[model samples]
Target: MLDYSVRTATTHTPEFLGLPQGAWVQEGGPQFAGQGVVVGLIDTGIDPTHPSFADDLSTDSYPVPAHYSGICEVTNDFPSGSCNRKLVGARHFAASAITRGVFNASQDLASPSDSDGHGTHTASIAAGNHGIPVVVAGHQFGNASGMAPRAHIAVYKALYKSFGGFAADVVAAIDQAAEDNVDIISLSITPNRRPPGLATFFNPIDMALLSAVKAGIFVVQAAGNTGPSPKSMSSYSPWIFTVGASAHDRVYNNYVVLGNNLTIQGVGLAPGTDGDSMYSLIAAPHALKNNTVSPTEMSLGECQDSSRLDADLIKGKILVCSYSIRFVLGLSSVKQALDTANNVSAAGVIFYLDPFVLGFQLNPTPMRMPGLIIPSSDDSKVFLTYYNDSLVRDETSGRIVRFDAVAKILGGLNPNYGNSAPKVMFYSARGPDPEDNSLSNADILKPNLIAPGSSIWGAWSSLGLDSAEFAGESFAMLSGTSMAAPHVAGLAALIKQKFPSFSPAAIASALSTTTTLSDRQGKPIMAQRTYSNPDSTQSPATAFDMGNGFVNATAALDPGIIFDCAQ
Candidate 1:
């Protein structure tokens, strides 16, 4: 057994920004605990012992256990030569090694044990045992669990341990899942680049998705994390439920600072009093500290021992440091400062921004340290003016002030950045048209729905962040549409739990029609640009980017209009 710890159960419930929490609970909870549904998850396999789905397995074949009904469609070889790094242990490799009659071949195709933790994390979220004693990545495990704890799950090993797999294998897995009579199919994988002559191979996958849809099996796919762009993977497929990412909070505690040289007359400046404040002070130029090199031409060793950073150089004076400088040193510098706060105390660390990089701050782990980031353009002018004029005094203030960084539950729709406010993540792929190449004007007619993906906290492997190089881990925070698809799959289980009579198309319809158009900011969620043509008349509101806003489980369960596809 790999030494893995469980994540702490979050007190906050996941919510769709701009969507009502009450509606979610009322519609999804009461209607869909997915009583008799069996969902087939095709990707990396699941850890059968995970707590969330402890009760979901069954040894008997037909008339499966009430909670679940399926078997592991074990197809690939174990411990093949290619899988040396992914599948550890001689025991896991025994079967494959014996069958191949050679250790080298065994290493090439390792057994279905998850070398990359992605499959396990997705599985746990979709339908793991409800409770367990595992702690990982600061998360503890217990009953506060997946969307469909009672739903049964079937695992398929399609993607290889090397993170690549034959497309044919995937098509086979789909056929197997369908033959197994799975009520839903969840796929989080995508092609690296469209395979050469992709349409030929893709036609089958496309047909598989449509075939699943026709079989009354709801198919949920990740919208891919290739961001700032609208085109991402099979997300364009019309028959499949495509999901995008959104921030969990409506308001983020982000700050906009002005420097001493900038005009500060209108803004307040009483140290910490004004949310945004600027001051005029001469400080060290650029020097590295804590293994970090300055953005300008300077080495880490030279900067650490340089006299420019001494108290004499910065004492009682405001210092400006560029954010770009820290990357050279890594986040370890931040951690070190927090660890040694009492030993080597400083006034504060102010970050100067550079135009080349957009500043998107991650939630700091060591909660109690003060740091601030200023835009590069703003910081440059301040630096120049303060350097030239010794008597320059700058002031600044703003409504956007730093708030304690803590994850919180955000409900309903609002677009302002505030504490724990949800927004569409910077990396979530957008859509203007569905895969069918239809030109529907509204997102409600296209891209379709949203789900939980992007920086999602979940199960991790024991290897830790540094060791687990691939996308999934024994435990860690992962971002991408891959994370989101499972959430929808789990919800599909819930939908089946409530309306056993509903067809997959009806379920997809309920999910689509119930989606909200406004984002956390209350602005209409729209698709990003799909083509370079400047005259493109399509806006974000049309079927281009925001397919029907995001998925709303609550509304879907109680949808007023159910889609009735023509037979």
Candidate 2:
């Protein structure tokens, strides 16, 4: 029962990688946007309907490469025409899960259709059709284009949202992908643990990838998410080009302004309340209409259940709630809290980070109404202190007499830049190369390179069963070395397209050797150590933190030297 878990793309990538988009020439060669290359994604299935996979992005008709012979699994969810010129192939492998009786068709799609959004997102990052508009929470972030916008996608969906895929299924998917003659295979998955001794490289998945490399197919894998720690690299095989996650220049920020004129920066993609005026704030427990209700009746501070709150008392006031472990477990969500707020006609909502939920990085959640999520527990403490000081409680029975706490959410959709970027992400797996189950180091330099993986915007499945907040959105912003792998995969496609004769090792060599080590401001690349003090605590990145530094797409086109690895 060897199970492999998921890893989890997109925009501002092409220019950042220095790859030219659409009709852009590549040093006396045809457009290097992966025109004739195919990228095989081995992860959760894909969404056939995402605009990023549409084949109509070009004036000329898209034609499937003659070398590709993959089939699209036609089911009720995934129809016959799901495979187009751009999305050339689609397939699913779940015999292991089915035999093990863990295959729940109700939640995990039997077809190639993506049940979890991970596959679609990674595919879109690798080689989704160009110029798809990204709109989430009614705000347009920007148009997203892949690194190799014209590269063909061949999907091998083996992973699922309900349960992760098994090694047998993953190996089968890899074998079939290599059999289909895909130019590149992108794997955003890793084993639950390292195998013992030589088994590390002898594992079925890595062995199949070895065969793929022997067949001239490039393989890119994520360097796991267990990072900022030594020997955390998951893909330790020397044949595969492993990628680590890093930050990019673009970032979105939101803040809350208290009635006392103190502003606290936070994370959320939400709007502000009416005008600049502050509204009365009340904690969920204090606003309960039924004072006799037991604490066990509902989550007192999470605001998950609408009936647990007093609609009349909540209306025209800013409701305060807690962000807890329930959010991580999917037992509670910002979307559910927003629903509770809207049902009660609350003016806005503020979520204070629970002290219990530590080391968890909060992404910018979309809010339908005015909302703010205070990610720092310290900041949450400050907020709670202000709220308590403004509270006027009844002296006799300890009831809230007056709800005097006040605050306002500010518009948070605007994009900001000028921060140093391409720093090795804190969660991006680091290396001294991982040890086998026997605790022996592989002696290989892992995370062959680093790429933009934080807060990446990419296509999402409408059936986003993975994230409750993004269930119906067309795009999602995700972070992981999973996203980083596809960035290199797409770039590999471009390099493959430019030099059709280049071996996988040669392509990997070009990318690794031509990387840039400076940020946008010409500063040396840095590595994030921890989330606690992400901004001020970073130090200069070492080779283990960022391998050959951030990938430079343009320079890779002509690395002048290519190291050959005998397959």
Candidate 3:
């Protein structure tokens, strides 16, 4: 009865894993890129219209898997022909939420159409069509492709946007997905709380998934997002393959240059201020409308209140806003600030880190207008000092001010590569596995593997129920262990397609053993500790931080040796 919320692209999936399309083969056999496999996903619903889920990618006619008997639930929103060859099955289970009187039909679509973008994102990351243009805010970051683009996706919408979901509904979805004879099942969700000792394995969801394993389905789950702490794993059952989140080499960098010629690099997916011309810069508080009453920091510093802003003062200028604690608490957002800037006819925006808000990692949030965020408190201090010194206020009343601060935003559309990556993300749950509620530890390793989960770009639902910033965006960038699990699931499909007779345990063994321990820089993989503002503190990761290490999909194709555990 607890609600669980929702949690991309540039791992160059096929290329980075060394499983280049049509080139990676099993010994002397045909290409085994998940052609005949079916991946079943249990989460929020999916967006049928997304090009990632479209069936017309290949010239050769794609057909539904003969062994898969799953059906698409047709409704007004999810009309006929929603299921194509690529998306073979789609269904939603909300009876439990309805009985609990928590299901809202409008927000949580009654059909398999995803209102929350989580399911669509996860599904596309696993088995969406290959090489779909990933455009957001009129910028093309890159083309996105699933790990197993040739595989079919079967979606079971058990979780909703309003209320995460109930165990009964989740279990029901699992039973049906298993009955449908899916080759793999990917779960991007974690329980809000762990069950007591020994009951963890006996829980309805685990037990049903265990049954699926017996029936030859590979199960993969996220190793929860609460991490950098020991024994924080949510998926503990040894039968399930748990995945942790890791960083990839790809990164998008946006920068701002002050009139004083100080260029500060930051994160933002937005356009640049009119072609290298530094615009008139003014702070949000200084741009408040004449006679505006008693404005708080939320309204004046963070630019959350558009009504308080003076259009005349803000027009054609780059407004400075504070990235405050309210932003972390969900009371304020970068999107709202952007909207306010647009409403006031501001040319662009620049956000400085509020020293009060500490230890939070800022992802590259998308913006329609030209903008950038200064993530480092040190850089923010530098920028603020310059701005304050440049201000010319009236000596008598301190009311007649002349705005002199100026800066220009550079285009943040391009991506940069060659970052030392595959390092365990700070939020990817760590483990020596948890034993019980008393906080005892188990001997078995929890996260069977790690995969690229930070700053992943994938298809997004138009409804965007969980994220207001990406409401109408076709693609979004997100980071979480939830984003890591489907990667292993899709890779599992590739292994299954290659070795048709391999048991689930054997496949897991292949994935677990065939991993690389070094990063692109030829150094040992590191783990983020999340103790400081920039959160860049790192140390060589332990087995618990990155179990067995980062997955190498091509090496997994021919592991040379595989352990066959009797189920």
Please report the candidate that would top lDDT against the real structure.
2
Candidate 1 worst ten-residue window by lDDT: 2-11
TM-score of 1: 0.61
Report each candidate's C-alpha RMSD, comma-separated, in the order given: 10.5, 2.6, 3.0
Q: Kindly list the per-residue Cα lDDT of model 2 for residues 265-299, writing each as its tens digit.
A: 88888888888898999888777767643355336
lDDT of 3 at 90: 90
Tell me model 2's lDDT, rounded to 2 decimals: 0.84
- The lDDT for every candidate, in the order shown, is 0.47, 0.84, 0.83
Candidate 1 residue runs with Cα over 4 Å from true position: 1-13, 17-32, 45-69, 72-112, 124-144, 160-164, 198-202, 227-233, 250-426, 432-445, 452-455, 464-475, 519-523, 526-540
Q: Tell me the tens digit of each residue's lDDT in model 1 across 1-567.
A: 111111100102244422125433543442234445776777754444334444422433223444333343233533233211111111121232233343333322344454546666676666543443434322342223455645566666565443245445567677777766778888887655444544422455657778778877888877665554544434556677877655454221333233422332111011231223333333334222332323354222112223334444333334434445444335324333322321333333344444444434333121123433343345445544544444322346322122111111111111232332233455566564323343344233334666656445455433222222222323444556677777778777777767887887888877778877665567665443432221132244444345566666677778897877842
By descending TM-score, how would the candidates be arranged?
A: 2, 3, 1
**Evaluated with TM-score, which candidate comes out highest?**
2
TM-score of each: 0.61, 0.94, 0.93
Q: Which tens-of-lDDT digit does each residue in 388-414 have in candidate 3?
A: 888887899777369888889997887
Residue 67, candidate 2: Cα error in Å is 1.3
Candidate 3 Cα errors over 4 Å, as ranges: 1-11, 21-32, 57-60, 196-198, 291-294, 436-442
Instruction: Give residue 101's lDDT in candidate 1 (0 to 100).
Output: 42
> Which window of 10 residues has the lowest lDDT sum in candidate 2?
22-31
